[model samples]
Target: MSVDNSKDLMMIDNGEGDEPLSQRQLNPIFASVLEARLARRQVLKGSMGAAMLGFLGVGLAGCKSDSDSDEPVTDPGTEQPPVEQPPAELLGFKAVSVSSADQIVVPEGYSHAVIIPWGTPISGALPAFSLASTGEDQADQVGNHHDGMHFYPIDGSSTDGLLVLNHEYIEPRFMHLSAAGQSLGSGGVPAFDAQVGRPVDEVLKEINAHGVSIVRIAKAQDGSWEVVQSPFNRRITGLTRMELTGPVRGSDFVKTLYSPQGTATRGTLNNCGSGPTPWGTYMAAEENWAGYFRNGATETNPAPREHARYGVPSANGRYGWELAADGSDRFVRFDASENGASAETDYRNEPNCFGWMVEIDPFDPDSTPKKRTALGRFGHEGVVFAPVTEGQPVVCYSGDDSRFEYIYKFVSAGTYNAATADGSLLDEGTLYVARFNEDGTGTWLPLVYGENGLHEDNGFYSQADVLVNTRTAADFLGATPMDRPEWGAVDPANGDVYFTLTNNSRRTEEQVNAANPRAANLHGHIIRWAEQDANHAATSFEWDIFLKGGDSGESGVATNIGYDPKGDRLDADNVLSSPDGLWIDPDSRVWIQMDSGATDPFGNCAMLVADPNTGTVKRFLVGPISNEITGITMTPDQRTLFINVQHPGSGTSGAEFAAGNYVSRWPDFDDSLPPRSSTVVIWKDDGGVVGS
Candidate 1:
């Protein structure tokens, strides 16, 4: 019934510098659940149900620890050295159980804390935050929504590192004290008339809060992980200046009235899941950006085909950012405007700025991010690259984060040279779309110029046309429709590619297929594809459904995921639901993160670990109420895990909220401190490898 059985940490409240001390033992509630599962195995061992796999193979499931197993917390100062581990070996990683709570929960011997929360000021000069602050105040602080993150260890240091985190989308209610709680922009237009919408200052404020934040993190010798105050910490928001790069550099499509030569843009927005390139660059995907712009009809030669590729409607802007500034024309032009006096000067090129994969070198804080247009984009959620090897094409796979969109891959033109471990060799590449043939096999269809259905008569006039309007180009060649693809992670051991198809509601019951079986699909599944013979540039691959979500018993059979109907591992018994963010640790254990939206009946989202080699799943941690568990990664040493809890208590309003009894008061539940959305690290009490 429960997983964690650890006792609550005894916190010292000395008003300053005091931290919580964990009492090393399982949480009582989780201890009981583990015992029940063990006891059930004993009773059913010889019974009719025992005839199943666990009863016939290896041995029956049983509990390993008892009352005598209660271990004492050891001081980290005198702890022995951590043994080095191979990438395929788990070392001492153990799947400890954790107690379930409406708020954040972790396993025994592990501790968590909120490191940085929404609206937390990064700049020392910015004023401290108050939840009651107006939209103006939110501008100077950390953005409201937090998503994908990466932890890079400081060179030659064991306890210090850098954190690059995405702020994702903004929450208007929490950011601005608005009455209806929605952002009040007049749809991407300039607010020349104060009566039009939210002030331009407000629009710019939100834009400035929607990108990435970098901070220094440290794990003290005592085993406590905290944010280190330093000048390296900075925020890159929607208003931040950025430069463009790649084959399409200086292209006409990228040209804007603001930058006629197409060299730069404002910022990255709607960022979703991400990956790290072989050369240590962070690749953050911008998902669902089509909703942010408004289209004005004043342009002369609008490209309808190009506009449809990005889902830009020929009407007013969606988010209304134009009314805030005079050149507000820049905000709503993604609408495929061609009403310009001449073809050379038309605004149809506006939509080209977005949908490209952006590569940010986190190490070089001052470097301009490169929008790798060579890797065609369509609501990108992630860019997972195959491991680099000498003379092998550097390949990266990505999922288009929209219902019925297609998955894509980019194969480098030059072979990956381990000699140059730097990323320069990745500049040129060939992009391909996927086609899942009937009979279970699939092929990577090339979207190259002059390829089948890519000619001028097919709507794509040239190679630039195919790259700029990627979606229509894919549609022209008939790429298979996938169920709302999200994040992707590659298994280090087997090299299997796992992607999350975060439920799509548009499919009707009759449309249900083996890959996407459910109509409403409240519970999503993890799809793993193994490229043909480890060739990242291969043209074909085989796939299988690794796991699907549903309650056990007769209900889960519909998912056909090899679920044990009468076992304790049933979906109802286990809390792992709606897999979203994903990562594969050194040992190949798939770490799953969830983004439980409105349709998710589960209280809050959580994280779990699954041994892909064995299909054994275990819940790891629970997020704060109303929060999404996202951005998971393990330190190179595998001694620590970093995860983000975003938008906790999101639905609370002025009328129903309270200071002490709010929807969630995580990390400081007793009203001792104000709570904020944050990233946390969970490690064992003995300073052992995390998850061991």
Candidate 2:
């Protein structure tokens, strides 16, 4: 999700600054490991620490997903990490300079164009984007705040494909023209009493703007992309009906008034990052979904463990959807308090139905998106699948995406076969939480019901219960709490798993550990690991620091060398902060995108490419002011790259926004228009592979 410096925005930022909800202190502190290794040696020698742990963690899954057409794109069964190619052979573009300009910047030889900004019609009535677009219009147009996305080529054609993307959140101040005149509440939302409520239609529009979009895009003869209207274009909004699959299905804990049998729910909220499954399905993660619900449990009837661990509010929800003036079930469901005699008769369990990865077959428009609960419930940033064999248990990884949260690995119970692989393989699996040790090694602890003290005495009655309260179970298992683990990428060239620890301002000096070496972690870092014997399903692995994201001029600064001074890759041109979005191209070039309010040397949030073999980092692209550079993908030929610029004017103060002064009006830089999040298509003037 795109983060901002605003103090009042509760729903945005993917809960990056939410007060650390984890109170259980039994988990091992990562700082202890670093202290043991570094001890009194304060003088950092080289940029890369001398102790360089060998691993090339890719930004994306490091492999190509299947084609959206009938034929498979690439066989995951035959996938193998090719021998590392030389850095000079892949990275051919000159580094772009950082900038504070309210526009995008790329290398001298590259060109870019914007397409499908928020409110651009893709299906149905095809409403043109304007401030007057209605709640119903949003259902047919592109959603606000584009985040994680993937490009599924149509029949192997680079020019035609289904471009599926996730809308992480919305900025109400910009969404509604009425908000410009009204006095605002937190995050510039129109101030209103809870009972009197926000306008039902306004609330409806915000909800309509919060889900996934699948649009058919084709390259025109002029070498530009445009939206193609067809049955393939669909919008799965916050009100779209979906199903709950796996062990958590039909469980009493999730029995809500809407789903009496506990088999389903409505909407996927706060989608952050996304990835393609081995079976060609797209997985949209449910991140920061807890902020959408309010549990008004009193002293007698307390909130459940699932709700409490996730920090469900006792007051108004982030958007106050529950307080819609019409009092419709669609609006009232956001209030998760006990309204009836029992949990089964109320919306108390509606929050439980969320916080899981939603699987969608982009090719099948009629298919209901399934929430794969077997992967466990938490703040899932995204899911990255490891390369699968012809007959092997499929493995994948996900991070909780909150401060001090642990990383997770899910191994499927059934084996994979290219001819028969489907979503069912994800239904029965072992969910493991990571525990990074002091010796630069890590263990994957299974969250099974009977094993590892996950029994009744420990508050886990079954595998469903264990997964429902996954964070608590990891705490009991003594997993290592990381610095807001955001996204994971398995190197397509090497099996090493890479995750971006996107920062933790609360981690004190005393809490510094090996996996998270910095205290007051305002600037984030990336950590990578290779599983035991190069096996994705392996229970043990060796870990190391890939890159530390910060500036020497910033406070709480450590030596820029990261963990290995000898391998210090961070230079004046490549310094970045809060590494939020990550993707590696097929050639093993790691692409890192930023999300914080970094300035000066690191100007705006930018995307940088790194050569894993040589540790050379260079800026690729920088976004406009007050926007997050996220959701990257490329054509099968790897010539055209697509990335999204989200929440472009988010940094403006509430007073400035109320006065109709936006921080940016990007893509459409006119005085009458507000900044709209949009996708950018970039290509080299020479038509060579992007970043080459």
Candidate 3:
């Protein structure tokens, strides 16, 4: 789905005033100029190549002709080391082909089974899911639109684990219940607004569906995974009470009536991408959260500049939830209008409480979730940390997940001590925005108030203000505006960070640069960078385009020098567009998942595996039509893989639903059942390691 551009605002400094720039207007002209300078330097270096060679006492060797003889020349006194072959497991299965089937397609030797689908009951007391299930029932059952997920092994046991999932958003047609007590095709496309105006129960259900779910899943005696009832199984809905931690906890920006001290708040919305901490916790990201709030454009005192920058709308919210206030603070908080004299007396600051990285402890159901604000928030896609080492400060990287947004990193103030490390380690950190130079280098500019014009003179008063308005701070630091950056993964063996810059159609030819070279880039690309001296906490780094997403048949497909498969040719099977989900497995192979739309050249969304060293990408699996392949994880043994198929048959219309002409009926494939998002488990039929 296209992001709401108005919500993804970019305030640019153009010398006259802070002009709002659309994604297309926020070009990489600075990067282009830097690239021109680098090109000139390269020309100068080439001019002195001969002189440098002479100074090094090396002779210039000319190409030998075939007439010089094709005889083998060997040095008699020197011995050559034998070539070592990669393990068979390193080079596993062959790549699959592009598929448009209305089902999950895996490699030839692999088999898949549905582990959990939307509305599956996990709590022991919850009733089994059915068309007649109530809104309260769904609060305890599995949520809709499963996006990012992670598997945490139970006591380090590979056979059992806690599955943590993020339910991004809902399909109203599939979720709203009818007056006749039926759910499927009850209210249609307008159900989202209808639920907010009346039937407040339906709004409650959606609120419950928008957060995170933690359930215990274990391998049965037959080797299939099954949800087991345990105390660990819990649903953290939009109404759940959570504590605010770090810099912005008691700041004025987050002083809502519900949280007068700004120490706590209720719920997390739009949980998109996710990650797991080394200390066994889940980090759920809040993306596209601005649409949930109504900012009241006609209000006497408008929202502050920071609020506008984050795209809190100046009118009714996307779902109009505020209309269902009905004398309760729950629904009323969605309206960010100045209802009282001060911020603490109303819900004006409620929008500020969201758009953060919420840390949840899956092992302890009673533990309250924490919103770690020190990480700096701005539509956080996800946060992936480098491999943790004792005595070294932990470093985590995150993408802003919006058009023309910036990527950020957080280096903890304290050194990691695995025994005592927890979410508290994330509480104190220096947030920095990445500035990618066109000369194949990048810098992490500190967002500290006094360090880089992030002071009152530049409209920032405190660190909390800087952290709350991170996008504005990044703009002041002159960070490179990127394509929609979705997910980031770090190579375990080599400390290289890889990020998926999902398509940016707004970019024009004038915006293309050495890093982002595509104009009107519909097919996105992945970029990887190695920090200075392989140090995760370093401010400087070297980077290059890992691979470009496009059809192999298309001419002039852009690719970096070393990534070209065969003298600038791209392998057909490796062609994929709009890369989104990314994961670096324990074996060090990078698994890339695509989020291609219907208009994309690739037939359906797919998951591909790549040898990071070779840049050889091969398709692994494909989802049903109009579905996004997201939320990937694997067992400790690497024998079982879990993948989420979200919003199968998403564009089904009201007429189509009434006519029983569904686009996709996946997982169950039953004509009587409505399509639902699901998580599928894939493993080799021979019980070997996945991809083997």
Candidate 4:
């Protein structure tokens, strides 16, 4: 049977509806606001039926429908300008319309080029790229499905820099090189059956395809960017050795046969979003790492709660990797079963070694990646640090990417030292989870042991246990559960932190809170908060909705579920949905990227620019069909913008590929060769600041 691209490619929630995580009730004030908003929406639905509502360009309460009339209810040109305009720096960019094109569509006067593709060689002797390349060949080449990325300037020059990118996941239909009529056993064919194990070679190739890649890119004399092979180029794959640092280092929860002391592990998987530190290191987050392991339910000594909480099935692994063990410890490590007498004799604890903020020194090719555990472990979408002060403690914020998960913050115990501070600063810190009160007030509840029932009386025995099982500790403290929280961006001008609450389809009306208003929030929204006294280290905060993403033609009354709507929606550009990736440049301009599915009517996923101060958003660029526009970064001078087009023809099936009915053949646009995810660089035709 062929894979279903629509259901398979989308984000999976393996731990859905296991247990209630939050015990605290929603804030009454916020609950009242939601009640009133829903009441008004009901009244509107009663007064104006679906047909009349569409003509008025007003969206129905819970569903979306096409409007019969193309004309706007009120021409935007007739409205008077606001008394106070946004800063002059935020204006002047022409908005691009939503599109389903096979190319990257940017505003007029801007140009883009595919700089680095999945098979590009970055180090040693340049190797030719072909689908027929062996697993060893891809082990030395670029990985697949480019997600988050950053640009580190070389010698402080914008013209030359190191580009670091994360290989989020792989699309098997395009990765393997099979003969014209080969029976798909392995060799790149995806194995979905538990009885049928993948070929060891195919598994090895996939293992080499799931980590981070760093390459040097430079601007040519023609002002276009090109990948240059340099000594700094390196690839950190799933087989790479990684050190486990911070409080959980050498803990009993992480001890395994490979590393009895638990100080190290092999590989970083599902690296999604990332953050660059002030100390010149890259922090990559490991998301969705649980599915890789398999724990049999029939084990005589089973750890069901542990496996269930992390969403690892007891019967079979997500990819059936353990079936290819073949007496090798490398492959057997994925089998988290009680084959051995004790946990230390098997790989039962291997899953605990992942799901962390891994720190890698991009400048040092030989540096060891450290998993900073004091930041607390969950399904971390990414970690974004607040602007560092000379003497203040470094503060980092992260969001758990599961539906109804909590947002977290970590304040380092040590003060900033520009000359010598490194990942050690992250070793000792206060890991706090957010508790958003109903009255627009929030508090950061510490997850430290013995502070709030996080002691021996509860399941947590020490701080390490609290850090290891962060979700349970947060749940014990009644932290507020939120919609699927994804990437976070910290504003440079102000200390305000913004997070993208990517939509939650499983969230019901009763589960809706002040922060997550919509019952079934299909089109996600962005939420921003300012720490008390403008200090990121503070335990309290004040927040408000920044933007509500939906159809621009939605009625004002129906859309007024959050903050005031005077300047919220960007009607001219039709904005976007499912806001997944976000970045704030040095100039304080907010860049928003989308990861909506194929069903979205606003066309394919796109990127937008937002004025945080004025809450004004405009579409800057739209990606190709079925591709997610992610990994936003810019040059030091802010002249060039880099973004990743992930899985362009994402929902394509293996049978479809064999039958020549693929969804998209992007980047190359050549039907002869399979499409590949790549990094594209955008720059103004005339040398001006991007979005200026």
Candidate 5:
């Protein structure tokens, strides 16, 4: 797929942390495999058995595909495993070596294929991927910078399913051919020329590129996967109509020129990590969305508390989308200044419409996505729901992906009954922010309107106001300021919750606490907790640092900071830096994806699998350069794994871009094409569970 936004990604990739890959012993299984192949070769060299054995499939393990050339993809031997599943919890594959190459690197015997890249046609008129595609065409094609994906199997068939993913943001220079290497804005964004403004169609096209894509995909008879045309293929973009649900639905905070009643809004911006609901729905988290809106209000006349708390810009917006040459209302909405006769006459309340978890029905193309405000709004990095019980309160957790931000959980007021529960359960819930105590126990500080300082005296008017100012409310309650908390996952076996604190370059030694032990957490860490008595709705819990992500010298906690062991640094087989995307499969293997700007010694961002109990982590895959490895999922049978590679070959210099070159031209190494973000389907040669 054709995608853009190199500069935007370059900005985020400018973090601190680097490391070298450690060496590991090759799997002894290879010796046995070689012997078996040799012994059989003489007996069946000319028989049908030899013809069907496909040497590539049964070849020795631990070899990476040579993606740089036109060589055929290397598959595991032709022998398929039995229908009965093998051991599902073991990390069977050997750790892959560190790589900074501009190609995907999976364990030997595991093959991966790039699927829907940005601009890949799946619905509507099925427009082909091209730099000249119109904004209208983008809405009908795959969006850019794919993130947070999941595959919903059709009738439980692992080979067929709906592949859904979120398109985070875009790079105007790379997205628009007219501005290539020209008119650069902050962080390499496409700037608005005061004399010419921005082309209305270009801005529209970018907006259309930021949202969600649901495409049906199926495995071909030859083992490769392809996009399947289905009625469910759809794109939900920034211009799509979405209803606001929960306490803030009709609240004045979201009132705008387009929706005075405040019951609905246009767009879902900055979608980063997401989760699938127990009821077969999808929830996309809005992260770093504040930069999309601007308020002209000066420092002396600052924007509203909601906007100010979330870092809404006081000047130009991120893309300056509001400066579209035609100055359309949809474009103007990006300007949230209180310039009208009142907020109702302008887009003053527009910023309030974002930063909430949006729920969409992948199977129902016509269903309007719902913004579940009861989950509380902030810089939502992603969401993870606790395993549901027949009649227990629905519980889910989310992290605000900014330095010093807090983690929060929402417990539904109404108990969950799978047969009847829906988004409404999220509409009436008690949202609680976390407070990490040095005593190894954590508290869930409730954000209910009249509780604690969250009342009129503190400027909170109602539940809606509390949620709108969730960060501020959490601050008043002395919630733990984290190291830029990102994605979270809950262990299906134990209900323990794990969160990735992806570094905080600002915290000082004076601010380091037990939960966040490092002052300048250059290489972030993961923290996990088990609810009291193993109850998801428990208000108190025990917590500890799962591990500190760093190179050899910088890895591990050296002091007994509370509950965890005081020592055990990252070894060669499992070195990592800014741990970001996280997921716990059904078998309890902890999957970690990296996202760091300065991933030197460690090469580019990579994926790893870990034993939650032993704190043992091993590299699983390494991605292309200037790319952040995020978003992951697998088929129901766990035979096929899907992960997203975003902003491949990013961080191209203006000069380099002007010269029509990029850091990488991955997925399609053609020199004429820019780097693109796309979904990758990975499978083992023997049809075994991934990671095993």
Candidate 6:
């Protein structure tokens, strides 16, 4: 559904001595299921009543309306008849959510297998993965957790491309030493590690496993996708060197012992959902970046106030990398210290190196990654740009992947010139925070200088301060804090922005408001926005909830579930929850991927699809036991879909081996092969549109 961009001017900040949405109880009329369902029905069809949804003084008539002209209207107290379900097949193949296996199960015509797994050597120089591999193999090869990824076509090559995948995190057991090829923790420590106060080598290996990998893939004449051996298969891990770009480059906040000018940093960490820029660069977001350091109870940097804003607690050394060499000095420097002699001479600036958007040129392996620090740092899940418009500012949206965090956008300072082939134009941009108003309109608050009290004693002293303490700056500006925002994608047919707010457990009823309306949001929702006048870089927009995840049969279904593309409202019976990775396919089909870990009744994580226009959502595929379905990218031809099955045996520990039950023995078809984390491609046997 399209948004009414003409309604962007009525935004009101809560800072005008007015009660915050958190303070006011929801209006009883809007809170009713009948009202909410009606509102949602209107939302699904892309329209809302002038009186009810005109909160932001928006022109309700301007919204694209879903004409429920054919369906029989029912009373509020009555139930609607079930709509006819689509034939349960994807390209003539029945798609089933495999329940009893640790594998990707498909119907009669489809087959799946892994081309590469943990510890697999990318090149001859890289050591092969030992059956009982140590952390060393992890450094030289792929890491354990294979999550979100992208498939890029080779120049002039069709049906053949390089798959750039993300290894989100480490599986210490499989990565390190263990008898059954997996160990939770070792009974002994190496001599070098014992003296360092940290697992030095192990830490370094884990560090090296956290980035992206490029593997050449080719489609057989039979339509099956497989990896092709080539030297182009390369790994860009956490230890790989990267360059800093944008306004924050060489800023004092990012300067560290490694690169005093802050022009460079060691590597990317916790790389999650990714974006392929129109200019051909890959944008990898660093998520949960706050947990990587160890400072042990007090500020390591001399500046304590600044360190506090980034969630760098002195006593939180959970990673324990600091126990290695020089304990607190070598490893602790990454802890976001406040006890450094000075900002210029210490590692207090490390946290600033992360949370910003990092861009890599997959075509140019030797190119250094550029951290576009202008995209204010937080737990960035993914970045999705609007289609590039010639001579217009390049616009992109991102979500801060934390409970109550905010959504953001970066608009290039220079207008994009399609004729100009260089992608470097992304280096300069104006970042803005979203402000959703009670009146149904919104505004983008500038995160630049000379505005929003950014350069003064407004808790910041300079441009660097605003960029470094972005969250605090955003808070002061009264930006709307969403419910665990994750990935976002723009509609190819229209400019509407689609983003997922993965479940936020911290919110309570007291915090419930219109925009984010759940307490302990176990079932997350998707919020979509359209730019003013359909312009990518417009400072205003219109927004609404697109889909709500939960049991399709629950009571909240009536109040919580919005419209799916099928022209039916979601009920409490379907068990999809925690909507995470999102992508708008070439045909504008909204693909919704779930990362169900803590609260899943659906058994395992799965991939789902929704036709946003009619609000119709359907289960597409589910992963095997103990794995999350992530990193989905379709081939340029749109017939093949590549997905990552990460850590299928993740929770399995060495102690559990003695038991008859294993967390999972995944990718196990013949049962002779040891389970390995890998990427899988889903395509039609006859070679047609993936979800047909």
Q: Per-model C-alpha lDDT, please?
A: 0.62, 0.81, 0.76, 0.75, 0.79, 0.65
Top-lDDT structure, candidate number: 2
**Worst 10 contiguous positions by lDDT, candidate 2:** 1-10
Q: Candidate 1, which ten residues in sequence have the lowest lDDT sum?
A: 26-35
lDDT for position 98 in model 1: 32
What stretches of model 6 exceed 4 Å from their correct place? 1-100, 107-110, 124-126, 131-136, 178-196, 221-224, 296-306, 325-332, 338-340, 421-423, 555-574, 598-600, 653-661, 668-675
Q: RMSD for each model, in Å, please? A: 14.6, 9.2, 6.6, 9.4, 15.1, 8.7
Q: After superposition, how far is residue 426 of candidate 1 from its true place, in Å?
A: 3.8
Give TM per candidate: 0.78, 0.89, 0.88, 0.86, 0.86, 0.82
In Å, residue 504's CA in model 6 sits off its true spot by 1.3
Off by over 4 Å in 1: 1-102, 124-127, 131-141, 177-196, 297-303, 313-318, 325-348, 421-423, 553-569, 572-575, 598-601, 653-662, 665-675
Stretches > 4 Å off in candidate 5? 1-89, 181-187, 557-567
Model 2, which residues run further than 4 Å from truth?
1-26, 30-89, 183-186, 193-195, 553-569
Candidate 5 local lDDT, 228-338, one digit each (tens): 999999999999999999999888888888988999999899899999998999999998888888888775665666776666767778778888899889899999998
lDDT of 4 by residue, 314-350 (tens): 6555556677635478888988877788778999888
Estimate the lDDT of model 6: 0.65
Q: Write the per-residue lDDT of candidate 3 for residues 1-692, one digit (tens) a residue.
A: 01122444444321110112212224335535321112211312343333333321111111122333543577988896686543334547888888888988888899999977988888857778776676688778988889899999987888899999998887766665452222234223333344436467766777877789898999999989999989999998889999999999998889989988999999998888999998989999998787788777554555665567667777676556677636478888998988898988999888889889999999998999999999987888888989999999999999988777788999999999988998899999889999887666678999887887878776778889888888877877878888888899987766668899987776767777766777777888887776765678988776666667777643122221122232333466767888999999987788989887555457889998876544456889989977899999998999999999998887565567766677888877887677889999999999998865
Model 3 collision count: 0
Best by TM-score: 2
Better of 2 and 4 by lDDT: 2
Superposed Cα deviation of residue 530, candidate 6 (Å): 1.5
lDDT of 5 at 652: 69
lDDT of 1 by residue, 429-479 (tens): 789988754333468888887888677665566677678767766765767
Per-residue C-alpha lDDT of model 2 across residues 405-482, encoded as one tens digit per residue: 889999999999999999999999899999987666679999999997888776678888888888878978989989
* TM-score-best of 3 and 4: 3
